[model samples]
Target: MYNSDSFYLIASWRKEECPLKLSELQSKFGWLLIPAAVLVLVAFYFLNPQEKPEENLQASLDLIQAEPPQQTETPTQNPAPTTLMVDIKGQVAKPGVYELPVDSRMTDAIDAAGGFLAAAEPKAINLAMKVVDEMVIYVPEIGEEAALPTAQPGAAAAGGAKEALVNLNTATDVELMTLPGIGPSKAEAIIAYRTDSGSFQKIEDLKNVTGIGDKTFEKLKDSITVN
Candidate 1:
């Protein structure tokens, strides 16, 4: 039923309507156009290949991570000597407290003290006697009478010239009781006193005991010793 004039009119109306619709879309979606453009640029930037890092930078990082820690060296110290103290007196070149190796003999002590004097009686003490801590070695002169006795119990003088003396510092309760006028009670008291006050400095210190007096000390003075 359409004629040529009708077709022309329809084409004109469609062209006008197309232009109006495009204008309406631009006005309503103007803000949406900016956001769409930003999205496209972001996508392009992310998809693009990035440049590789420098080879030297990666190598330096690996070197730092793979490196071993430095070690600190400790210095060694000199060990102290294992030794004992002994006292050498009478007829020796040097007479005083001296340090000697453990298990050293009487001759070793004498040698350490510069040997014996010309008048020293070598028979006064046993040269083979082992020296101990706080030990006292006395070398008497020739023709000199031995007054004090040996510190060790039942051990004779060097030439068996005198009796053995009791060591007050190391004597047991039974040994002390053997002394004249020293009963069991007195011996226990002496041990208790020495324990509280430490070793006796000299034989004369025995008089300092609670029950011992000058008379009792005199009886045992020649028989007792402290070394």
Candidate 2:
């Protein structure tokens, strides 16, 4: 409330007074420094941020999708069987022409024919022998004389008479082809065998030719002769 004299007196006191203390200066500015420090801490936290939970989850999903898929295996199938027509007769349960695998035996024919009859003599036949196309399998009755079973499919001559037997010693390729299961290649092979190895000495000697096994011989033996 004083005039210019009071202002002059206050200026003179300030000039003449001792310097202010460090404790007093700190007390006045400490409240302002607290708010400034809090602002600095907030800015630092925003600049250096931590990883988010959503980002970590998304990275895991991307890794799973990028992986390779598993492979599947394919299935395999078995080959079809080569078939042969066989004629079973006499004392079997049901005797007739039957289709069997090419590698079938006499026992297989008997089973295909509904097995042997009660009076059948299975001992009379070669059960373990390999059966070929058009082969005859005869099961004789008990105590009966069984004629030798031979392969003679469509082998009848004119007027119901038996066909003349093929002569392996001098038969031509066309003549050899008349026999069952003898094709052009086999007929030619027979001629080649005879030219290289002379004539067949006996019917059994025909087995010495190439491509002729016991099974092939069994098919040819009944329809061929060397004489």
Highest-TM-score candidate: 1
Q: lDDT tens digits, residues 42-90, model 1? A: 9998899565578778988999989998889989888875898776666
How accurate locally is residue 38 in candidate 2, as Cα lDDT from 0 to 100?
Answer: 93
> What local lDDT does model 1 show for residue 75?
100
List runs of model 1 lying over 4 Å from the truth. Answer: 1-81, 147-227
- lDDT score of residue 85 within candidate 1: 78
Per-residue lDDT over 124-197 for candidate 2, one digit per residue giving the tens place of the 0 to 100 score = 67777777766655555566433333345654221111245889988887677655445577778899999999
Best by lDDT: 1
Indicate the residue-level lDDT of 150 in model 2.
Answer: 37
